[model samples]
Target: MQYDIEADWHLLNTCNYRCGYCFFTADTLGDKLQMHASPQQWQSAFDATDFTWLLHMTGGEPSIYPLFAELCEALTKRHFISMNSNLSRPLQSFVERVDPSRVSFINAGFHFEERERRSGNAVFLENARLLQSKGFPLLVSIVATPSALARFEEAADILAQAGIVPIPKILRGSYNGQRFPEAYTEPDRDRFRKFAALAQESYREMLNTSGHPSIDMFGDIHLLYGEPSFTGQLCEAGRRFVNIGPKGDVIRCGGPTVYGNVLAGTFKRAKRAKPCNTGGCIYFCQKYTSGPSGPQETRSGFFDWVADVIGTAKHPV
Candidate 1:
């Protein structure tokens, strides 16, 4: 049998912005002020992994971590790294140290709510442009909230002017009794389609045939409006992808159960994919881990694996 391993590490939960729709709010992340892992802790835990790992580092804004540059430099030496950030922090040090070739990609979230403060939209675009100019692959994404949807075209134009394609992401929370991606009013659906068209012509085509209740290489899909569910499917989560919390507790594909500590290196791998007992998992971890994989018939399967990563890099959520 052949397989691949990917891990999403929540390195910190301290963000500079308080976007109203953020899912990882203070209530969600208990003791949020105290939730951070030192660079040494992360380096040690990462170095313990024996596999050629595809590491996705996320946080309440990973760019704000004190040792962000040092951590990135160390991790890139051993594993492929991808980061999710709000792009509010400095980048020159990162550009100078970490090799762009070792980074799979960076997904920068454009928070419309915070545009008036700090360096604002201009700075965000400049930072993204700088990274791209340095040969780093980056994707700019924005939450499609009602207010943001109102200004989606403007944001897309700015990114386009800077040679960046803006990916309009479905807001994960609910609005006026409607859950997003799973449920949206026809007007809202039409708006999202328009937003996609503004970004790229191909995105319009993707929005059409991509079926209801489908999980593509991009993300979860329901019809223009429908319920999302994953209660009974067999998921290759713990076996293929896992979530490592800041303290190193490992959760299987964002499932509720904690298997063990990856920092201590005590979790065991299954020989085959396992059925997911967790009901209704629609998070990114579940979507990617349980999606599709080509035949892994060759030694290492490096080419196929890299292709998969590249495919995902194009559709950063």
Candidate 2:
């Protein structure tokens, strides 16, 4: 059977930090990225359809868009809006202005390299604590790397000590066109899973442990000690969800803009076109589509699918 439809419309390509692993990394968004979507296009897209359960507003960084608040106000008028932000902005002002209930929760991604090297970690932590204290629903997203696991736990500890509860969303490592898998040797995955299990015990206990609400945006959230299990049908992106790029480009999936532009037509028609860069789709999305079946083939069932894409940054270009 087919599935419910959701749309992830990429509002702009403006971001404050140029993260290494981001799909719309500086290098990637370098040429095509722009803040240029007409009001007519917005209304047409909004009026032309009905299955937009979640209208995700993303950017190089949504806060920097200047008109983010206006966009949020516009979309919330029609759909349940979720703005994917790095939580690096003092958005309390912005949130208060928009539809509070329509705003799902902010996905706070702590850019460690930037925080440590560029903007001191102390300030970063303080910003996070401030958001948590305000009682804004939030999801903490961290990238998975050799040192990532330990750093994540440390960050969690710091947040807890500050009296903040955060849900950890672990993402696979994607860098300069490469992807990292959770093979047996990665001790970090094991440590994380144990931590997650502890968080599941109770809500209050989870504040100290992992229970903030862990989600894996990619298939590697959990490590399969033996063989991985596959469930649900392979994702046919356009049918399930669609992402409209900044310049009116409608991509089949978030992997890479590899299809028609909805501004030129509707999602139903966009699906008929082919992805412009299908071969180079990031690993997080590429593995699901037509690949060899095996014990390693990861599952994209209802549970796993949404978690993998919901708050994830675009794969690094």
Candidate 3:
């Protein structure tokens, strides 16, 4: 009952906000047609999996999907359900319909620029409180842009007062002629260090003092403070982890090409971990399939066991 398979489905490319640093730009969104799998399609895909899977739904914003609540209701019955959302939309309806126990967690992104726009901070906080009150494991995260970092203390204070700890994520792209995961300026590096320190402290005080056992904090520290070389390591893509596009095509980890389609019930051979041949490897992509032993031997082992009990393969990648 070692449920080792993990899938991250890019449900759609339609987001309500335009965060300046987002890789998914208006032009990028324009190039791709917005689409979602029907509930039946979701069921078929779940049914077709030879191993149990922890299914993650992500997009421009998953809450905006037309049948979001219905889809959640269906998926929760068969597999663990987790979502990456902006939390700009109301969640009472979703909370009422989907069982909280089946939800692995919700990663809510708080865009500082979007605070003044639709579903402002007040509404976002209210929704978050509602979800937490109902016993949902909610991880509130914010991008650590310089501007966002300037106001982070205030935001952190507010969330801390309400029994919620905010996790600060390193901003992914570049700014002011500097690229990320490669060419961060001294000031940029300092800002991220300060943010991570604050987040670690807050996590200890407000959440669990022991921290997440499976997460390697040292690895995170190295990612920010030092250059990690994955240049020629065997990356376990297509075997234990994969990225499924909106149309159900599977990509090896975050690779550029589609290997197969899950809905077609055709799975390509699980490729052996190979030496990374790309120019640069981003942390997210590297973390997903980096080690030769695969996710089962690392951070996702707990979910693997949980999936065995629930009769599905579960892991988050």
Which candidate ranks first by lDDT, i.e. highest? 3
Q: All candidates' TM-scores?
A: 0.78, 0.66, 0.79
Candidate 2's TM-score reads 0.66
Question: Candidate 3: misplaced stretches above 4 Å?
Answer: 30-33, 181-191, 204-220, 225-229, 269-272, 277-317
- lDDT tens digits, residues 202-223, model 2? 2344234422221233223433
**Model 3, range 1-317, lDDT digits (tens) per residue?**
12355567788888777777777877665444454568778777766775666567887788888778888888777676677888888988899988887776687887866675664787788889999899876777777666776788777776765666667666555754566544555676566666666556655532363234212231233344334444555665566666788878887655764568877777663756666544332433344544435633543442343345435432111
Which is better, 1 or 3, measured by lDDT? 3
In order, the Cα lDDT scores of the candidates are: 0.63, 0.51, 0.64
Model 1 agreement with the true structure over 1-317: per-residue lDDT tens digits: 11256677777787878777777765543435553456667667767766666677887777876778888887777777788888887798999989988776687888866665564777787789889889876767787777777787777777776776666677676654667655555566667766665554534443343221112213322223433344444566676677777778888765676668867877665556566666433444234334344212221232233335434222222
Better candidate number, 2 or 3, judged by TM-score: 3
TM-score, structure 3 vs. true: 0.79
Return the top candidate by TM-score: 3
**lDDT (0-100) at residue 58 of candidate 3?**
83
Instruction: Return whichever of 1 and 2 wins on TM-score.
Output: 1
| Model 1 segments more than 4 A misplaced | 1-3, 26-40, 117-119, 176-178, 200-223, 279-317
Ranking by TM-score: 3, 1, 2
Candidate 1, lDDT over the whole model: 0.63
Where does candidate 2 clash, by residue pair?
Answer: 14-61, 15-60, 15-61, 23-314, 23-315, 199-211, 217-308, 258-275, 258-276
